[model samples]
Target: MKHNRKLNIFLIIIIIVSIIPLTSCIKDNVQPISKTEYMLGTICTITVYDNKPESVIDKAFARIKEIENKMSVNKPGTELDAVADAAGKNFVKVSKDTFYVLKKGKYYSEQSSGAFDITVGPLVKLWGIGTDNARLPSQSEIDEKKSLINYKDLLLDEKDSKVMLKRQGMSLDLGGIAKGYSADEAARILKENGVKHAIVNLGGNILAINTNTNGKPWNIGVQDPFKTRGDPAGGLNVTNKTVVTSGIYERYFEKNGKKYHHILNPFTGYPMDNNLASVTLVTDVSIDADAMTKNIFYLGVDKGMDYVNKKNGLQAIFITKDKKVYVTDGLKGNFQITNSSFKLMDKK
Candidate 1:
């Protein structure tokens, strides 16, 4: 009996030693996670999950700060500030990133038939719709600025990597697409740092990399156009997709019962008076999604649908002045209309 007991004890020791290595290996192979949030003009959040240390989060935040410093028009002495200063003078040489963005803006301008123009800086500055100095500009002032608002004046030398505005008083404003570009850049940096799962939210431009912990799609809310801020319209569920919305309610000025929004029509040199109250676009590319939202908002329903249908892998939901919701066929199963007063109308 003593020898049998000894043999049983020896077997138990072997089993215990065998489990020790497996436990240690599991612990050593555990993934590291870090989340950082900073309020830069807009709320910016970067979440990183990998085997990297906490310092990686700081590096990522630093990269975001670099981009913001270069791109922010609100910041004095930035690259954007230089461009703004050169508004009516010689063309300013910008960073390659800025050049590339301006090229994309020009392409979108042509594609959207001038609906998406980066050269509307003059009008944007004039109206100051979102600022405390918001007001209506004179007809003569509007007409004069409209003359210089053509995107054709934007000269791009691809081989030399330079951008120039052919005419004086022409300016480039990336307000419509800068956040998306920044988010994409941030994602690239995180991926380079061995981050496989993350989300970068630069204000409304949200970019999700890889699947969530549960391997499910990210639930991104498209802000309700008619509803007040902080309310989601039951939103849409997106997977490997970017959702962006441009709405009149986002930035505007109301005077004498007249509402003037920040989104200006390049043709009329005034805020768009179309039936569209807001436009939300979903696509795989945040930059494209950002540009399309503005284009669709200005194009209104018929032309907007045509543009969306021509492009593959793009979907949109448009809210009209009457609170009517119109969505592309691709979004039939994904987008839900929450406002009862907002009826879903089929495009003919």
Candidate 2:
């Protein structure tokens, strides 16, 4: 009788143990804290999942704002403006953050073979893309500005943490890479604060932290170049990764029925006519993905494919002007084409 009683008690204990996990999962719920602000020349969104409190999200945004204040070329009295003001004549000492970004900019400039030059600010101002003043530049004006666009002239001093532009008219614009660096910084801050699941979107550059509460990959949509905002050409299943896209559709102006995009070729001082509509990069590093979109888009498909194929852990999705999506072999299963209007090409 005692043996049977003990057996029944053991069975009850087993049942109790089985129910505990479900109850714990129900209790350990995730609350998403999201905040949006107008900064970095675009909308910045930071979302964090925490069961304890919502204060970490604020810190993350503050970090982003701090970066914007230091690096924004449009903002007067900024570190970038300081360097511009001191161009050719003097060296300007900047914050370590500024120095770091400038150094990375130089690295990408060399890697992309000047296809993505931070020193293209002169051209940017002359063309004035992404602003109310945007207009087509005269050939003479384009030629003059092209003379000022040289990444080789940007001198960075590691010893003194200073930067000097060799020419007086030269300017630095971190618009291409700063957003990604800010996103990565925000992620670092969140992780340091013990937050695991979060999403950081600076303008359209996205960094998905870890995974969702159920430990599933976060689905990020690739914007449709033909359609309006929020329309997805396809979807990328990502977790703990950064997804960045550079498309002609992002910033452009219509003039005489011709569209002029912001991504200019440093050689010609005009919008690049690479035939590809958009290039999307996916990687663990946000800054790398951010800068690569511009570089690879400038290279177009053939050279860009050759460049990306040699790199490790880097995947690309190229949407051509003919409504075709070319994905790298590594992203075969992870990328899904949702828009029927676009057809997926065979993997290269």
In model 1, the runs with Cα more than 4 Å from the true position are 1-41, 47-58, 84-91, 339-341
Specify the poorest-scoring 10-residue window by lDDT in model 2: 18-27
Judging by TM-score against the true structure, name the best candidate.
Answer: 2
**In model 1, what are the clashing residue pairs, if there are any?**
none
**Candidate 2 error regions (>4 Å):** 1-28
Q: What tens digits encode model 2's per-residue C-alpha lDDT throughout 32-134?
A: 6776666787656676766746678888888998999999877788998888888999999999999999999999998888989999888988877877678
TM-score of each: 0.82, 0.90
In angstroms, the error of model 2 at 158 is 0.2
Candidates in order have lDDT scores of 0.70, 0.81
RMSD, one per candidate, in order: 15.6, 14.3
lDDT of 1 at 184: 77
lDDT of 1: 0.70
